[model samples]
Target: MKVYNTNQIKNFTLLGNTGSGKTTLAEAMLFEGKVIERRGEVENKNTVSDYSDIERENGSSVYATVLYAEINDKKLNFIDPSGSDDFINGVAAALSVTDIGVLVINAQNGIEVGTEIHSRYLEKAKKGAVIVVNQLDHEKASFDKVIEDATERLGKNVTIIQYPLNEGTSFDSFIDVLLMKKYCYAGGKLEISEVPADQKDRAEELRAELIEKAAENDEGLMEIFFDKGSLTEDEMRRGITVGLIQRGIIPVVCVSAKKNYGVGRMMEFFTRVFPSPNDVPPPVDTVSGNPVKCDAASPASAFIFKSAIEQHLGEVNYFKVMSGEITEGMDVVNNKTGNKDRISQLFAVAGKNRTKVPKLTAGDIGQTVKLKSARTGQTLAAPGNNVVFAKIDFPEPKFRTAIKAVNESDEEKLNEALQRLYMEDPTICVEYSKELKQTIISGQGEYHLNIVKWHLDNIFKIAAEYITPKIPYRETITRIAQADYRHKKQSGGAGQFGEVHMVIEPYAEGMPDPAMYKINGKEFKISVRDKEEYDMPWGGKLVYYNSIVGGSIDARFMPAILKGIMEKMEEGPLTGSYARDIRVTVYDGKMHPVDSNEISFRLAGRNAFREAFKNAGPKIMEPIYNVEVWVPADRMGDVMSDLQTRRAVVQGMSSEKGFEKITARVPLAEMNRYSTALSSITGGRAMYSMKFAEYAQVPGDIQTKLIEVFAAEEKDE
Candidate 1:
């Protein structure tokens, strides 16, 4: 392999819907560049990009695979990511690091949900794109219909660069508008041929439209084109390149990746027309808020876009050099972890295979072995430079489940394996909910979680089960109430004796002003100086008042009493959920100095608060999430009806492109297995995303059932 300069490198990411032939297209491109002697098929599980066990089993790409090929002295790095929504993080990460996106579309199924989703990402990233209409040889393929559908959804910026001369089962040749020639595949090779007489007029019309669109990229070119009625090949190429980089034109190309039809011409366009690495602007430094130029002589800085764990290779981290040159043996610091690490080895990766490289210059993508602290989305810079690049923003997990080891002895192994898996795919979130006392694993959907479960059992020899996660409901008071308790224990040695009188009330931002209250026909005045408010770490507030004016309870015992009250707050008196947003006033209490230690006062405080809580109107608050569902317009009615059954409040509805977007707020408990249910209802055509919104009181009927369930569980334990 030969080293190429930054200007000679072109980085692109292949994205589209599952079964859109992106992997096969990449294979064809690699074969055309002579990087591989033979093309591999997904059905045979021998493709360079989809080589992982999970991918082979699912017959789809799971992880983003990187491969490079040299064509016309230009190094083109192709990042092929999974098209399924379950692995959208891979697509986002690839887009963040690459300059151009090659969106492959199935000629038979044009502008599906996945196509719209990826197109949204492309627009958000403000990157250049080229549409590749693949699978032209399919029986139902319609080149003209696909082009029209694409233009309708993607807008007028889409322009045709090539079209199949004989599409559908007989797709053997395509006419190139830019070159004014026809490319035919015969005898296992591509040969230049003259345009067919029957399609000559159609080809000429498309060529004229292409010239006009390309000329619009520059004023000088437009003037020249208008004066001469056409553009030279060199001038047209320059104009198209500029238009692509500026996102003013989205060139459409046709190909039959499996048959290798028009693949060589596609490679030629990639090498000569696509934007190079230098065409992309530098990224801004996250810490200093300054643009960091891609200069080989500057301090070394790189961003890790993807990380994976291989059986024999351990951890392989793939990163793009943002600035300066990274050489083997150089020491760098992980900005996120602040851990220093030495680069022991560097290699240019082609899927799972790697070739050792002495150095990787700026704008080049390469992989490195075992960095102690480096992970996905981390920025690594030379020590003392202190440069931090912005991290890759990954979408939040859409589904969650509680995971527990099947065997008691495998708990430790399960935890270690989960951590390793998290390092490999940052989208897999493993959280230990301290309140629920369960380990929750969240991902894109049910299938994603299942994959993780498979890894746990097969790779780590630890079997685990997934269950619906328990909702972290909160307990709160609604009314004011007072209660008194006397903890008098006459156990033989050191008898405990203490008495506490507390008033419980609903808490808000500003309330509970000190006032006079009478206890047993006696008037006691509470002062503002004895009140304090505590902001609980979990979520809510607790306002405590120590108003013992006559010295009935010692000042030293107040903390002990507060600690007891907090303990009860953590495990609420009703349903054992965390309690929040309440006010408690220990206006009157009696303590025997010798007998009333922390334990006696603690028991008194706990009993008094419990009694007051029972009198105060307590309600359960469940977490609610704001969910947005994207589905085909025809299925909107069915999806909306299903959401209503789950106690969702439909907030709004809108239409984008050809899909209906419904926004709603639904309780977390009602969303169990929602991903699966939605898939069933929509036939896998709809997708939804959700995030934490707020907490609201559970319905009266649901609250009654929940309390009963909690009581039963507590009795079982």
Candidate 2:
């Protein structure tokens, strides 16, 4: 493969809904570029983009397929990512390295969940888009309705560059407004000629609108357009180029990827109308907050946007040269891990096919193998440059489940394999919850994690099953109570003796310290000799007041007493959950100097704290999460009713980009398997995100049930 400069390269991502034929479109593009002898179909399971085993089994893309095509003396790098929301990480990875998103919309269904989702992502990234209305040859294809839907959903930026002449099963032609020409296909061979008289007026009107929209992006073009009341071919291309780069124009084109109709013309538009690598804004350095220009003379720097383990290639790392150049056998330091690695091999990748390249300049995407400790979202730069590109902001996981090995002995293996998977896909999150005592795996949706499990079961040969994840609840007290306990153990040689008197009360912020306590009409005046406060790891504070006057109990055993209290705090007395927000006051205590020890004090402190906690009106608290759910307006009421059943507190409701968004606060326990349920209820047209809000007391009925369940588990143990 020849090394292409930044200006000669154009990178784009094939993004759309699952059934929108992105893979088929990629295959058609590759075939048109002569990279392949023939086109491959997605239904035949031989498309260039969906080459992986899992993708073939699913008849869709699972991972982002990084491929390239040389067309019209220019290199076009294409990243075809999965369209299912479950595999959205692929979309994120592709978007991070591409300048334009070629959204392939199904002609039959104009605006879909995936279309809306990917459009929002493109808008968020502030990148340009080329709307490709595919499947023009399908029986149900409707070009006019698609234009209307695109205008309503994607705004007026969606201007038509091409309109199908006959969009049905016999669809074989389209009129290109930019060139003011007609493209017809007979036996899959394209014929370009003048627009017919019947379609001339409509084509002229669209061309005028296109020229005006394009000219609006550049002052010189606007002057020429205003003076001439039209634009020349060269002037239109120049104006459209600027419009695309500035995202002022989102030109829509039509293609029957299956029949290869208008595919080459679409490819021509890509090279001539789309923004080149140098035209788009270069990535910024996260460390210096400066733009990394696409200059080959600068210090070498590359950012690894993705990494995966190939069948026979070990681990392959895919990166974009953010600045300068990346060459084979170049030595660079990973700014993230501070580990130097040698790029022994570099190749231009087209799915599974690789062409060895001597070097790739800035803004070019390539893959390499055999790097030491290089991972996704890391930067490899020259020693002096030390540039790190800003990482891709991946969406948070919406589904979670506890995964365990079906065979108990495979637990370690399962964790190791999961970590490897996480390295390939950052959206596949794995963490062990110490409080819940389970290893939880989370992802974009239930199907996402199921794919991970599929990889484990098939690739790693590790047997695993997902179980219900346990919620990390908390326990706290509501009232003040005091208790006294004594620990005395007598033996032939020595004895252990310690007595403690403690007052327990709920702790709240901005409250005064210990002063006086009136318990059961008995007033106990207290003097705080020494005070120790702790910020508990679980959420709240644990304050310890040592009121031992005159050193009644020597301060040496204070730590031991605190340790015992902390143990009970970690494993609450009622339900074995972590305790929080309570203050312990040791107003009085007695100890035998000869028999006193840390163990004795620890036992006395533990028992006294437990007794007082039981009498202090303890309650269990569940974690609440701030949830934002986006669903179609028709499904909003059903979603709200379901959330109410989960004990959700509706915060607000608003409309967002053709979807109704509902914000609610709900307990974590009620949120298990919510992603799956939402999909079922909304017919997979809904999307949502959740974040931790705060912990609140559980309802009285739920609290009783939790305590009973905990006691049953304890008895069984």
Q: Report the number of the highest-TM-score candidate.
A: 2
For each candidate, C-alpha RMSD in Å?
2.3, 1.6
Clashing pairs in 2: none
Q: Give each model's whole-structure lDDT.
A: 0.87, 0.90
Candidate 2 lowest-lDDT run of ten = 274-283
Where does candidate 2 stray beyond 4 Å?
A: none
- Cα lDDT, model 1, residue 246: 83
lDDT of 2 by residue, 1-717 (tens): 789988889999998998898999899899998889889888899998899999999898999999999999989999999889888888888888889999999999887889888988888888898899999999999999988988888888889999999999999999999888999997877799999999999999999899899899999999998899988988888888888788898899999988888888999889887787778887788888998888888999998988999998899999999888999999899999899889999999999988999999988999999998998889999887778887888998878899999999999999999999999999999999898899988898888998998899899999999999998989999999999989999977789998888999999997888888999999877898788889999889999998877676888888888998999999998799999999999988898969999999999999999999999999999999999999999999999999999999999999987799999999989999998999999998888889888999999999999999999999999
Alpha carbon deviation, residue 423, candidate 2 (Å): 1.2
Model 1 TM-score on a 0 to 1 scale: 0.95
Model 1 global lDDT (CA atoms, 0 to 1)? 0.87
